[model samples]
Target: MSLLEHLEELRRRLIHSVIYLVVGFFVAYGFHEKIYQLMQAPITFALKKHNLPTQLVIHNPVDGFNMYLKISFMVGCIVAAPLILYQVWLFISPGLYKNEKRYVMPFMVATITLFLSGAFFGYRWVFPGSLDFLFAYSHEFRPLIEVNEYTDLFLTVILGLGISFELPILVLFLSLFGIVSPKFLWKNIKFAILIVFIIAAIITPTPDPLTMCVFAAPLLFLYLLSIGVSFMVHPARRKRLKEAA
Candidate 1:
């Protein structure tokens, strides 16, 4: 395709993705209250465990409403993720061979599964543990967990992990395009470990080594998985295996 045609196609995909997100936003807005409750649950549990008040405080009157809108938007992104991924695939499909295009289903499935798994891990273990660690200090002072601030931290942990879990998928694309090979990835594994730990340190709410390890563990696993994925999808390896078959 010409450059102009490629640009037009990208525009079309963007429009479709935006429309899907808007629809998802409205749907999520309808259940925004429930979503807020779910988001607030970890903090509530932590406060209870610490024998503190379970309510999250809001200094400004509009903070509650703003949080509601933010929650809706985030949930909208989750709802629209599959459609947005599909739009992305469609945009890139023209460059792939027929056999490669057949991976669309697996790609979508793996992307969604890995993202949800990471989000769930953060919500179930990392977030609650961090909240407990933070709230442990409330023994000396009254805790006033602000709604907006809490929401920001919550999203940072959850969405950050979700996006991070897409490492294998990212590597798959790089290998498919012949940008990297399994040997290169393996050779650089030490560097990848260093980078992963750095990111875990940055993102983990707690300063403890245990919490940081909990955050970094899955990311390291995903990096290893990416190496394997590269081996499978790298053009030279795939072609050699096909010829042997």
Candidate 2:
């Protein structure tokens, strides 16, 4: 393609992405109050469980309104994610082979599923555990919590989970490219587990083992799953072993 063609394609995709995000933003903003309430549940629950009278307080005067905007924008991005993915696929799809194209639908579905699942896991399981742990530790002291600080923690965990859930896709991409192999991964399983804990330790804000394990376990499982996928790519290894036998 010529430079003009590439530029045209770029412009087209950008326009589509922007449209999707704007639509998402509007829809999310509409539900911003409900979303904020929903997000605050875990922290509130934890506080209640500990019998603490304190609620998250806002030091900044504008925090309450600004937080709603941030929450709405986040929701909007999620609402528009499919369109963003489609636009991304559209941009790259023209370059893919027939076999590659065949994989696109499944990949698209899997991408959304994994991302949602990760977000869900964080919200459902990890959130309460983490929130409870933190609040429980600090409850006796009764430190004033800022709304921004609480919101930031909530978003950061959800974002981390969303990113972490891309494990299968990352593995598949690496396997497709032949950069990593099943045997090589299997031989380095110890290192992989170590890496998983190291990553969990680095990424998670809380030092509680349960919180760390909650994040690390799935990542470790993904590494193992990646090895399984790598085997499918290297069937020649099986044939070679058979010939040697």
Output the number of the TM-score-best candidate: 1
After superposing candidate 2 on the true structure, give the runs of residues whose Cα lies further than 4 Å from its correct spot.
178-189, 230-245
The estimated TM-scores of all candidates read 0.97, 0.86
- Tens digits of per-residue lDDT, candidate 2, 38-123, equal 99898888888988764778877899988988888888998898879888788777765454577678878988998888889888
Residue-level lDDT of model 1, residues 58-167, one tens digit each, is: 99999999999999999999999999999999998888777789999999999999999999999999999998888785479898789999999999999999999999
Q: How close is candidate 2 to the true structure, as a TM-score?
A: 0.86
Model 2: residue 96 alpha-carbon error in angstroms:
2.3
Candidate 2: which pairs clash?
Answer: 24-76
**Over 4 Å off in model 1, which ranges?**
241-245
